[model samples]
Every structure is written in structure tokens, then in C-alpha cells.
Target: MTVAATEPRVVAARRRVPRGSARRHIIAAATELFARRGYEATSVQEIVAAAEVTKGALYHWFGSKSELLTSIYRELLAEQTARLRDIAEGPGPVQERLRAAALDVVAHTADHVDELTVWARSAHLLDDEQAEATRRERRAYHDLFRDLVREGQDAGVVRTDVSATVITHMFLSALGNTHTWFRPDGPLTFAEVGEQLVALFVGGLRP
Candidate 1:
């Protein structure tokens, strides 16, 4: 029996999803599993099962467990980079812009705590190549915060004596680490916590 022309076209189209998309699906599945079960506990076989793909497919996309983790890390870093870029480019007073950016970070972390947990847990387990790649991506993200601090200083909106590096570290440490304590159903909204943090940094407790 001969197949219809449209049937052949549909079959061809089904076989032609972008290579990058397939890899992303694998990474996303692995990320969820790794978050629920730590790196030492999760197996590649289990990851493939959760992803609903063959072991061969997973292997074809990411050569090793470390590589898969690296891919997820890069994906997260890309997301943060894009968000920070938008906040940095937006018009507002420096203080307002910084507050908005901090709030957005907290909100994002709260929403994706699972992914962040996976990233934090597996970051140190990466191979040397993956480690270096993660470091570079992290630095790019960090630079955005650093620039915000510089802008605050230049505008005389924040303390000039405080190093931009220190400020940036403190800001991220507070925002990113919220995943450890934040509950989606908690009494305090992410925005409230973010505002408190911004206030602490911008206007210290001293009378």
C-alpha cells in the first residue's frame, strides 16, 4: 500500500525537531530528578526513564552525568542573564531599578526552587571543563549585579565606601539563598522579603 503524500510530510516533520530542543528536554527532566534526588542518589538510567527517552538518546545528547548538569546550569544562567539585562536596561532611579532587579531575582528563585536546588547541589560535582564553563557563566551573571552596585554608587544613592563586589555578593547571597527558607505558601510574599532585603542594604538599621 502506498502512503499519502501528506503522511510522508507529517512523518518527516515529526523526525525533524531541532537538536537543541531535544537536549533541552533531557536537561529539564534531569534537572527535576536531580532536585528531588541528589546527584549521588540519581542514576542516569532513572533520568532517561523520567525523561521518557532511551538511554541511547540521553547519551547521544549529553555524554556524561556531569555534562547534563552543565547544560542545565548554562540554561539557568542564560535565563538569569536575560532577566538581569531587562532590569538593567529599564528606566528608573538607580535605587528603584536595583530594588526591582532584586525583587525579580527573589521571585524567580522562589518559583524555580527545584531547579536552583539541583544546580546548587550538583555544581561542585562537574568535571573540570564543565566547572570552568559554569564559572564563566556565573561571572557573567555576577557582573550584572556588580554593575548595579556601580550605578548606585555613581548616583550617590548608596554608600561609596562599600565595594561593589561586596555589595553584589551580599545581594545575591540574600536573594539566591532564599530557596533554603522560602515557602510558596508562606505568610510573607516574595516581594515583601525582597523589599526588606533592599531596605536592609540601602538603609541600614542604625538610627
Candidate 2:
């Protein structure tokens, strides 16, 4: 579709463009368009117009559409990973740390559901290098989270019957898919939903 046709729906609801940051605007515009129209349907030209930036500016920030998509995921993952690291290393009992980590990730995902949703839908379209890089970073996050579970298991608080790998995957898969069913206007807010999910996750870990 033409930029004019798509701009209204895509740009109207996006976060306000930051001053002197064409990169953020382009990323924001691309994310909205990708989430609403699917990756394959959004074109470079359309994103430029919607972002109100030149093609040169977009290309300067992102090498290509694939890079932009990967950047979106990387940026979110980086923030989440940093938060997880802090929680994992902070002074707390294993169970408490794990619970806090779980709650934090869910809240972060809920807060950025739109961007995560875009990544979920379009990650497969990324080039091999981009895909592998993201996978590696994601794996690091999972490993850190699994170590927390292992810590709990070793402490004899979390169940030993279930493997840490299995527990981690189950909880994360559920959290990762939250964007699929969650709605801001729904009867229960994501915060409420996240608390319940975290409870279920921590409860399942109990021996």
C-alpha cells in the first residue's frame, strides 16, 4: 500500500517521534507497520514516509529491513537480559529471586507487547546472521534463567523431578506467548495476569 494509505493507521497510534532521532521514529514506524500488516507486506518506502524520515536516514540506522527487524528484537532482548541479570545476581533467596525475575520479564513483555509481537511474527524473515545472533542472545537469557531454576532445585525448594531445562522452557514459552492473548482493554490487566502466571510458575517449582 502507498505510504499515505498506510500512514494514518500505523503512525497515528505510535509513540510520539522523539526530537532529532530519526532512527527511533523509523524503528517505531516499522514496528507498527510490521505488527499490523505483517513483515512481508510493509515496504521500505512506506516506512520512510510514515517515520517522516528520508530513505538515507533509515538506511543509515538499519542496513536493511531484516536488520531493522533484528534490531527491534535485540533491543528488547538486551533490556530484558540486563534486568534478568540484575535480579539473578542480587541478594535474595533463590525462590524470591526467581519469582522476581519471572514477574519482571512478564511486566517488561506486557509493556512492550507491540514490539515483541512484531518480532514474534517476523523473526523468521531475518537473514541467517541476524537470526543466529538473536538466537544466541536469547539462549544466553534462557541459560541464566535456567541457572536460577537450578539454584532453586539445588536448594531443595524447587522440585527435582522436573528438569530445569523443561521447567524453564515451559514457563518462558507461556510468558513469551502472552502477547498472543493479552489485551489492554481486557477484563484483567496483564499485571494481574502476570502475577497469577508467576504464582503458577513458582508454585510448580516447589518440591
Candidate 3:
């Protein structure tokens, strides 16, 4: 039997493009502009010009500016969620798995500083429903990481004094805030920064 090929990515009512380049270009342009110019300050016209696509084309892939912004974050969140799920559920010593999960999330955030910065700065502007949806998705990722911590706690590798909930949020808060001060050209490379952050996280979990 022949296997079926995966369907292509389509956004905004499935408008077709020249091999999906239109969607790719719009997302890329919007991410850069939203990161550089505040999302509110970045106009659709500017995005169109930067993307070299028409306003209609932009709208074809995104229903509204908010939708575009959400897409940027949702995609990144989806990618992170996949990685987190793998690390959380994959077989290993609970302590090692917990450490790996913390390191992975921080590293992922550091890698996507620009796009994540755009979302962090502009997510408040999203409409209530969209904002809630994003939060739900983000919360799911948080819960996945927390589950690993809970596993370690149950196994006595992690301290029972701190709630797994608090521990998870504490590490995640730092990981999410890396964009505020981290600089690629700074004395410490992002990898070094992530290492230090992970060390602090794992240290706190010690029994």
C-alpha cells in the first residue's frame, strides 16, 4: 500500500500561492517588522512592501493584524510544545529528564529571542479570545514541564518544600524573560547564559 503525502500549509481560508512562498514571506516579514518596530507601529502596508507582496496577499494568509501576530507566536509555541512533550514523556531518570527539560526550554527561548520578543511585547494587544487561546496553549506547555518536575518530586529527587507549580513557573519565568537583557554579543554567549540558568533551576530542585 502507498502512503499518503502530507497536506501543504494553508492559512486564511486556504488561499493558494506560488508554492506557499506568499505565506512564508508574509510570516517572515511580519516577524522581523514586529520585532523591530513595535507590532502596533508596524503597518500592514510596511509588511507588504517588506514582503514584496500585495496587501491582498497579506490578508489572504492572515485575517487581521492580530491573527498575524498570533500565528507568529502560535507557531513558535507549537514547536516548543513538541520538544517539551518529548523531553517530559520520553524515558529517563526523572532527575535527568527534569534537568533536560529545563535546559531545552531555555535554549529554545534563547534561539527565538527575536520572534518571542515580538510576542512578549505585543501579545497584550491581541483580542480577548485570541489572547485566551494563546494563554491556553502556553499553559499547556507549562503544564507539560511541570509534570516532569512533579515526577521528580514524587521520586524524591526534587525537594518537596517547593511546589512543583512554583518551581515550574520560577524557571519558566526566567526562561521567558531572557529576551529582555540577553545579547548575542554580550560577554556570555547565549549557550553559556542558558547553562547558568539551567544550573540555577536544577540546583533549586535538589532535595
Candidate 4:
């Protein structure tokens, strides 16, 4: 009789975890998995095992595997957007702010190299809706940086010969592809590399 009465409650209890340790563990595990194994190859079973959570926990928190992928990047993008927004609005000369802004982006990307590497490798595998959503988030970041460049131009510090749009793309392109060849033990320290990249950007902006 007791077993029969307990059966219903057991069935009712799903693996619903609140926004707590399990969710964070799953995200970190997934990020590492995707970075190391490639998103397409990583399986939900593997994620569950790595995260040490049940399948129900993953489903309870995230809608699907694609959502996990999007969340990883969206989380990073959100923090980056906040950083760029602060630097852009901070008190300073526009040219100095612009340089600082570009440096901030490169610095953050460098620090989260694995996440960036995951993004570079797995972005193409995302569906159209997922891809477009990520693009919009990225576009917002791009717009903020570009606006800073335009502000510099208006202030007569940045060059007028080149459009702000082109300058924005150029620096980002270099930074985005850094994962392809950059090495830690190379002759240039990462700091030196970042400084040189910023130099290339700021020098190009001179009127």
C-alpha cells in the first residue's frame, strides 16, 4: 500500500532544477565540449555525462541543443556589449575612447580564446534562425564600435578618407581570425600583440 501511494509522487517529480549549480555546470561543460569536440559532434548524452546532470535537467533549463549553442555565445555577447557600451560612453576624448574600445574587444576575445574558437568553428553549423539571431547581437556590438569611430571622425581626429564602416570591419576581421595562427609562446607576448594590433587600428585612424 505504501509503495503504491509513493509511485504517483515519484512519477510527478521531474528533474526540474532551479537556476542554480546544475545549470551553470551544464553550460560550462557544454562550452568546453563544443570547443574541444566541435558542436556537431558533441551529443546530449555526452553533455549530460560531462555535466553530471540528468537528461531532464538539460531539457528543463534549455529548450534544445541549438539553444545551448546560442546561449553560450549570447551570454558572451551580452557581457561584451555591456563592456563596449561603458567604454564608448565613458568620459574621454573620442579618439582615445575609440582606441580603448577596440583594445577592450581584443582583450576580451583573447581572454576567452576557447569560446571564440568554439564560435569560429561552430557558427556555420547553426540553423538560419539561430544564425540570424547571433548576427543581430553581433551587429549591435559592431554598431556601437562603429559609432565610436564616427564620433572620432566628427571630432576631426579620425581620417575622413576612409569610411568608418570599413575601418570597423578591418580591425574586427584581424581580431576574429587570431585563433587561426596566434600562439602563446611566439616571439611576441600577447600584450605586445594586442598593443600592435591596437597601434595598427589607431594609426590608421589618424587624420
Candidate 5:
């Protein structure tokens, strides 16, 4: 029998993570610094100082700066993935689920746009192992979404002429790139944008 591939790669945290405010401080500090200054420009020393935590505390929470960055993005993705699973599995028509999923993701990203922007800009700096793991997790998320599209197509609600892959990427691309042009102070609110995008998505899928 062929051996299965290795387990998913996760940036392992140091054992004996103590409960305290230090860990929260380190993450908050790192996120703010990384957003203000590019990831490569930010240093561990700066993070610890800004957090007002000792180097020992930061190290205990995260092994390295890159690991910290990876963990940040991973945490966001984990939340999105969990929410997607719930909407996908819950009772609803396929189109309704798709609309809800799309809107939910757009809203979540808008809420965390700063952290999302940091990841988008610095994700390339991550180590190969951590990066590959994230890619796998993301692919799983995409596959779950694609499955929803396929279900719609099978139900005769979504057009079958367009491939599910195309539909999936088309809508996801629009929603995923919101950080590029979205502005909180801009005329258009995120809720407004989300509603319009959902309308376009659902309309395009109609057979």
C-alpha cells in the first residue's frame, strides 16, 4: 500500500503557553507594526517593546516573526473556513447559501482589512512549509465553495453552460480583492458593495 502524504504543516507553537495578557499584547503590537511598516521592516525587538512584553514572552507565544505572521493569517482563514462550513452544511437553497457565503466573507474581510492587507503584501516572505500549508487550507476552502456552485448547477438554478470552476473563481476574485479599493470613509459602504456583489453573483448564475 502506498503511504499517505504527510500531515498538514502548521507552525507549531511553543509548549506550555501560559494564559496571560502578554500573548494578546504581542499579537496586537505585531499586527499594528506590520501594518504601519512592512513586515520585513518590522523587527522582533520592536514588537516586544511595543507590546511591553519581554522577549521571553513573545518567543513563548511565537517562534519567529514569520511564524507570527503566518499564524495571524491562519487564524483569519480558520474563522472564515468554519463559517463557510456552517453555511454550506446548514439548511438552505444552494443559491441562498452561496450568496450568504459570499457576503459573509466580504464582510469579514472588510472588518479585518488591515490584517488582510498585511498578509497579502508579506505572504511571499513566509517559509515554504508554512506557505504550502496555508495554500492547502485555502484550496480546501475554495473546493468547498466550488461544491456549492456545482450543487446549484445540479439543481438547475445555476447555469450549467459556465463551468463551476469559472463561476467559483470569478466571484471569489471579486470578493477577495476588496482590500485593493475598499475604503471605510468612501461613499460606498461595505454592506452596499456586498449587496451589489451578491446580486451580480446570483444573477450571473441564473440559468
Candidate 6:
């Protein structure tokens, strides 16, 4: 007896075939090479070889090396944006929510340090189009944090003297830089470090 192929089965198989996994694999390999060899020294051939994928596949997914780098950075930025949005929209007192938001930012950044490093190094090299896209994506996330801070200030939950933009920028810069000192096997967990950071910035632990 012959078996018939169904649409559902075909779709399921396609989904299970690791849709964007290959792209991520290439990005991971490229990130490692870039970190060790520097962006200019790392070649697409090396990246594909390291990822165990074909040059055609890499090209199909990301048109060029610069595009690949942009895609990877965008992926990391999107993850951060989602985390911040979730925390900002979570149900809690304004101050508590802001603290949670800050902690979430730190945790996500620490968790994806490799991607963060790639972003930090290569982001500035993106061409005008890529740079603009990244800036817009980043600004959307920043605006979310800014709105949250503004709400807190309006409700008298946050200090009224500081501008929301300033507060948001300060929190983002501090959390974004944590990758420099954060260690996966270190004494402090991301959560603990996040809390300490939030307390320092938000609560001002003066008492």
C-alpha cells in the first residue's frame, strides 16, 4: 500500500526541519570566529565551514556578511526589546515594576553576552540602511522604557525631578555594560546582580 502526503504533515515536517536554526548556527559560528579573529579577519567561508552548512545556504539566508551580522544583532536586540516590554507591562506597583524591568534587562543582556559582544563590536560598522533599521528597533525598546518611567513619575511612584529619558538611558547603559563584569560561574547570579543594580539606581539604598 502507498501512503499519501497530507498538507499538515508536510507543514509539520518543514517546521521541524529547524527553520531559522541554520541561520542561528551560522551566526553562532561567525560570532565565535569574529570574537577570536576580529570581524575583518573572519571570512564567510570560515563561518560556513564552522557551522557545517553550505555557502549557498548561508547566502540564501543572509545575502552577505554584513547582512548576516545585521541579522544576528537584530535578533539579539529583539530579544531584549521583548523582555523589557514584558516587564514594563507586567502587573505590579510602579516602583516594583520599574525594578523588575531593570532586572530583566540586565538578566537578558548577561544571558546573551556573546551576541551582545558581536553587537557592540560590529554594530557601528553597519551601513546606513542597516544602522537606521537597528536604531529604529532600539528606539522602540527605549521608548517603551521611557514611557514606563514617565508613568511612574506621573503617578508619583518615581522621583519627579529626573527626566524619564535620562532615567531610561541611565538604566539601559548600566545594564548593557554589565556584560563586561558578569560571569556565568561567578558568585552572583544574574538575578542577584540585577537586584543590586536596581536597588542602587532605583531605591538608592541609602537607609
Worst 10 residues of 1 by lDDT: 8-17
Identify the superior model by lDDT, candidate 1 or candidate 5. Answer: 5
| lDDT of every predicted structure (CA atoms) | 0.77, 0.89, 0.87, 0.87, 0.87, 0.79
Evaluate model 3: give its TM-score: 0.88
| Local accuracy of candidate 3 as per-residue lDDT tens digits, 50-115 | 887788988988999899999989999999999989888899899998888878877887787788
Cα lDDT of model 2 by residue, 44-101, tens digit: 9999989988788889888989898889889999999999999999997988999999
Per-residue error (Å), model 2, residue 166: 0.6
lDDT of 2: 0.89
lDDT of 4 by residue, 1-207 (tens): 456445343555545335578889898899899888889899999998888789888999898998988888889999999999999999989987898898898788877778878888788888999999999999999899999999989999999999988999999888888778888889986656877899999988999
- lDDT, candidate 6, at 88: 82
State the TM-score for model 4: 0.87
Runs of candidate 3 exceeding 4 Å displacement: 1-18
Tens-digit lDDT string for candidate 5 (1-207): 999899888997544324588887888889999999989999999998888878888889899999999988899999999999999998978889988888888888778778888998899888899999999988888999999889988998989999999999998788777767888799998768877888898889889
Per-residue C-alpha lDDT of model 6 across residues 75-116, encoded as one tens digit per residue: 888888888888888888777887777777777766666777
Q: What is the lDDT of residue 136 in candidate 4?
A: 96
Query: Clashes in candidate 3: how many?
Result: 0
Query: Which pairs clash in model 5?
Result: none
Ten consecutive residues with minimal summed lDDT in candidate 5?
A: 12-21
Order of candidate numbers by TM-score, starting with the best: 3, 2, 4, 5, 6, 1
Cα error, candidate 1, residue 160 (Å): 1.1
RMSD per candidate (Å) reads 6.7, 8.9, 11.7, 5.2, 14.7, 8.9
- What TM-score, to 2 decimals, does candidate 1 have? 0.79
Clashing pairs in 2: none
